[model samples]
Target: MRRRTMGMLAAAAVAGLTVAGAPAAGAVPSAAGDAVTASVWRNVALTGTYTIRDDEGIFAAGTYCNGNVASEGWVNEVRTPSVWWETTCGGEIRVEKHVSAETDAGGGVMIYVTLRFYEGTNDTNTDLDAEYNFNRYVPA
Candidate 1:
């Protein structure tokens, strides 16, 4: 009888631990609200000229431009340095970068941009029809 009671108590304790260690149903695991460490994609349309000072540094993947437009931009990586980049209509440009504790330390990253929609690929041939600017921020 004593042996049987001891075995039952041990089994119950093991079951209790298993249940306690298990996460609740439908609960999502998180990193205690830390900055996002994963890579994400972003899209923007260029019409005019503007500057984006992104402190979060989430837009490190680069930019994708579609439709008929031309763009010229420079990215200032706070952790490193600035890089000039541009793309014509129906083209893409890479602004590859990574964010970390070091990159997000001070003023973060910045991108100076100018976008124009022309009649064709040649900017000089046609006058600018539209101009716009965009700035986006991602939550930590």
Candidate 2:
């Protein structure tokens, strides 16, 4: 009886460890995955819709286009709506001058572009760039 009880306890301990070590089903596996799920941008164009989230939940969502660029003397009106990114006037976006040194004949270059999402027009800027290798996260 003693030996049988010991065996049962061992089994129970192993079972508990397995259960505790496993990830919760459907849980976001990593910070990057949680930040941008492929499901969130289904078939959307780079100019149509994009979204970014953080551990606190969705930080920004909006549209973008190369054609929507600024002229030499005016502020370009580009908006990125992020409910939780910053303070939230639906947020805003400012794309810096493109870094062209890295481009090739294909015009495909990887860049770590920084974007800001502000709470309101009066709020200070918040960096909305991805913390990880977000180049892969962007849809082709």
Candidate 3:
């Protein structure tokens, strides 16, 4: 009985580790979009859609290392809404937006995404490091 109990505990520990290591269900797929370097620092942005068949999209901006000031300017669906996001120069900020479906009836939808990097925590045109623009089309 002692040996059986030990084996059971070992199995439970392995199972717990496996469960903790597994990726969460419905995790979105990600792809590197653009990267910029300035003053020995690098910032990266990621772009992805919620799903291949959906008009929802995701964007992420982050700094490569710790200690610095960084900012991100994001525009979704073009002239619709714009947001300025900042990070503590180490982590990342992610945003999600849904594209209007009016164009879906016309066969596909057009999505405009703009990502800009700034040197400081606040986005200023003078402190802009790089800008990336994307025009994506999603079929109906």
Candidate 4:
């Protein structure tokens, strides 16, 4: 009888841990979002998307593309939103940049993104130009 009681207690403790607790210390979460787009100058048109999941924690993944760029990454900074990536499609338009989202007054989210082009050699020349800054608003 005593052995049965101890076995049941051990099982309960294992179940509690599996059901409750954060992921591993270095686990990354994801977010959900709707379809969104941002247009730059007449020379370039930017299209992007965001996804968020509000389960145990808040996580998000988003993407933006303009001309030769199709940037996609994930960010989860407490309550803020952000994204960044780099790509070399060769030819031209070697781009890397960041995206940010925040809560607005109307219970919606405001998204801001930037595109940067780098020119120079690694560890030798470090020169870059801010290509564009795009600000957009989306529904809650």
Candidate 5:
């Protein structure tokens, strides 16, 4: 009789649950309330090789917030990592990321980008023409 009563209570409680009692997926609780940030807004078109040039000791780079300012062929190295420009570039935004693979994949190339920006010693941030060749760019 006790087991039957407990089961009944449990079922009733579950059926009576409300939205006010449930949390959303990928939502972080703040002092204000549950909030979520929108991801994957602006997507820069990957065409040819994105160029990097040397200018004194800094390079010009920016994030693709609205739309990346591109020229003839290439723009900047637009990826998940936020890169900047200056004497070593003026910006203190840095983030770390990793990667994993699933089963049943073929052999391919792996590209490493050390200095995505220019060496910074040229006149302007154009014509220097630095390009990166990556095997694959797995989006996050």
Candidate 6:
């Protein structure tokens, strides 16, 4: 009889069925009240080799432009000093992101930019130049 009673008590203790009605071991608390803040806004400019593959376009060399970025998107603009022989020139902007254990520095980013300048006329009779495949990125 004593052995049976002790077995029942041990089983109850191991199953967390004590006199109280709280949770058992390894119980995790909910984190539904946490909040997050937005990152800061920044602007950067990059300058490097700008080239066009097939079609010849007149883009000036040795010029740089700044990019204004916000939570949504960014814009890039440039003015070539002088148009040279039909050449291609521009820079690209890329982003590299990482996370830190400390104050969430969010790691540094690397941006590459390419800018190109092309000339064309609105001649209706003849074949006028056309630009295509322009990719613009926007934040979510």
Candidate maximizing TM-score: 4
lDDT of 2 by residue, 17-50 (tens): 2100111112223456556322111121121112
lDDT of 1 by residue, 27-125 (tens): 222467655433221221123222221111244223323332222222222222222223342221111112111112232323222233332234233
lDDT to native, each model:
0.26, 0.24, 0.29, 0.35, 0.24, 0.24
Best by lDDT: 4
> Which residues of candidate 4, in runs, are more than 4 Å off?
1-83, 89-93, 122-125
TM-score, structure 3 vs. true: 0.31
Task: Return whichever of 1 and 4 wins on TM-score.
Answer: 4
What shift in Å separates residue 59 of candidate 6 from its native position after superposition? 19
TM-scores, one per candidate: 0.24, 0.21, 0.31, 0.38, 0.17, 0.20
Error of 3 at 131 (Å): 0.5
The alpha-carbon deviation from the true structure for residue 90 of candidate 4, after best TM-score superposition, in angstroms, is: 4.1
lDDT of 3 by residue, 57-92 (tens): 132232232222223222222234344233322222
Worst-scoring 10-residue span by lDDT in model 1? 17-26
| Residue-wise C-alpha lDDT for candidate 5, range 1-140, written one tens digit per residue | 32343234334322332211111122234456666542222122222122121122233334211112221111122223323222222232111112122111221212222222222234333332223222333332
- Measured on C-alpha atoms, candidate 3 has an lDDT of 0.29
How many times do residue backbones clash in model 1? Answer: 3
Candidate 2 global CA lDDT score:
0.24
